[model samples]
Target: MASDRGHGITHCDDPRAAQLSGLLTRRRQTLGLTVEQAARATGLAEHRYTALERGAGHGIDLGGLKRVAGGLGLTGQPRETFLLLAADPDVTPYDLVERRRPSIEELAHIDLMEPNPALITDHAWNVLAANASVARLFGDPGRAADGDRNLVLWLLTDGAGRRFADVDEVRADAVARVRAALAQIPADATLQALAGRIAADPLGAGLWRSRSPRLPAEASARRLRHPLYGEASVLVTTSRLPGGLQLIVHHAAHLIQSPAPR
Candidate 1:
């Protein structure tokens, strides 16, 4: 999916735009390709490609971004990170505050009815609602420190010291997911503020600088040894709800058919 935000020739002061342009230029140069050569390789017009390298590429389609990334031999974290950076800044699906989300009755029904641990998060990874099972596992997200109700922030910082079988691994996944989410709404001030706080945390900062992709969903199985549910193996699955809400469900190992596909 892409936005018709023009050819992205107009000037914009977004730091991410500059970073992407610089990265594209450097990567192309590293591969010993001139602007014309790289442009031709990616099927982009020469001037359009130049404009893209000059910090104005917010309108690039997903296919264009993928083609560009492939032509440049970008892969793994670097490729994933760059494509996210190149995506247009549209907040509709992500602007939780402005959208009319599902009713509380529906959200609470999942919380109250689900037998396993589950919670709902907004586009910014904020904990919109949590179930008793999830609360029992991670403590009340409402009691999170610094009033940071964000799921990633809560898991890495406020929910610190709580034992997850693989705390660092879990934190890394949280960092990557939050970082990717931020790229789609780089201009959101509220998300930016929370991201700033996340960066201040030593663990979060370390992972943020890496700019890695999140764990593959199909391989994401978390085992927690809580006093309430001792030796419980949980597999995380996410489903999209109306207005871009995300439901995160953690099912007991036996009850889960599988982790979500990557």
Candidate 2:
């Protein structure tokens, strides 16, 4: 038998709570207003503001926090804090606000094709979901490992780069895919962070600003030197899915032809 008493509570760890509380108090104090004055300005009662500053178990609302932020003249992304507060059931007033965060399974789907390497990436370019062919082609079906392994990273720095007979083409494909994903997630923090990190790398930075239209999907055979498959010319097909969860699926264009070593 197991207890579900603490099932959904997050950020309950004392240090985090204390840290957030301290931030709240400092922000308020920085405004040079007493608790009562701050509460009056923010349309909250003094006690409520005090409890939030103390990080007491009282639930906080996103709108209320936005008001507080407005009153204190704080700027930058407040959505992160809003989401954190929304995750705490005890601190949230809106039921919809407290719904569980979305999972990758819920965000994107995949389909495998035999004898071809294929996979789909979410708007953040995180390999949210991949298919069997992708694993077989990459020689590791489990390489994606959820959303942690960035495909761009593998193409840029890992041994995966050795498989491309035409490194330029692969780099072009990577940039095209990244640009497509960026179009779908222009303001996503996770994607922005990734773009920033990639931009720091000279090779990656060069492609970051490429304005080239997407490469045509007309079946074209390109040499690929797979660690396991030796050298082969693999035809590639790339398809983009529009809206919500932006996805791009890539598959071998010539699954039946035998490729010669480059």
Candidate 3:
């Protein structure tokens, strides 16, 4: 009789295993490829490919993963995400955020951004830090209630709708980002709770279920409404920091577009 591990494929119970399996299955289906075709494309035996899709295969190293990624036609960020998921299943972006902090020097650099609205957020979209401009523009995350400090939560449930002209577009983008992050860290309780809360809203629930593409890091221009400054078109850019933190900056296209409040 086979051992329990061999018979039951205990590893398949792991969260990462399930994540990989789902990703592979979704990609294959999206490409309209049958299992045999995908197996042939990956240069793997049909049985081996099936086992991989079931999250039961073992001993697939880096080269094999590369072959799989290439066969699936995953390029750019998608390919990189695939490789990282396969190679470091246990790595959690939140852990990186928890273990590191911005140096005073880094904070100084952020301060140099000055009038531009800039803030740092962790994988779960928790606002870790923000400059004065960000505080002035978006309402200081530091002063928000615990639940509202999460950008996604704020966008979906709190007052973000009042701050952006294209609130629907912004909400959709936030949902997509959260979906991608949840796939990478399925075991995170905080993320799971966040997803539940987002799904509680009718519009958010629809967005969560819809298949929307993840927006690029540098988003197109969006109109921001400030109580004192009125409305201005802003371009948002995001840069990855050393420790799973993101530096998001909003550059106004034409600052002071509207007259000041009386």
> Best candidate, TM-score-wise?
3
After superposition on all CA atoms, what RMSD does each candidate show versus the true structure? 14.1, 14.8, 12.9
lDDT of 1 by residue, 85-155 (tens): 77666423343222345577867766664667778776667777887777766778777653577777767
Evaluate all candidate structures by whole-model CA lDDT and list the values in order.
0.68, 0.56, 0.73
Please write out the lDDT profile of model 3 over residues 1-262, one tens digit for every residue.
1222112122444876676666777788888888888999999988787777766546677668778888999876676656666664554434323335666876887788878888887666788888898777777888988776888777875467778988888888888888877777687777788889888988789999994545445566788887677777788888878666778888852574445777
lDDT for each residue of candidate 2 in 1-262, tens digit (9 for 90 to 100): 1212211122446755565565666666667777778778877777776666556534656566666666766654343453354235443222222223234553344543544555555445556456666665664535545544667766776566676778767776676666665555455566677777678878788877774536335355567775544766666654544322334444453533455445
User: Could you say which candidate leads in lDDT?
Assistant: 3
Inter-residue clash pairs, candidate 1: none
lDDT of 3 at 139: 79
**Cα lDDT over the full model 2:** 0.56
Cα displacement (Å) at residue 121, model 1: 1.4
Ranked candidates, highest TM-score first: 3, 1, 2
Model 2 regions more than 4 Å off: 1-112, 139-147, 180-185, 209-221, 241-262
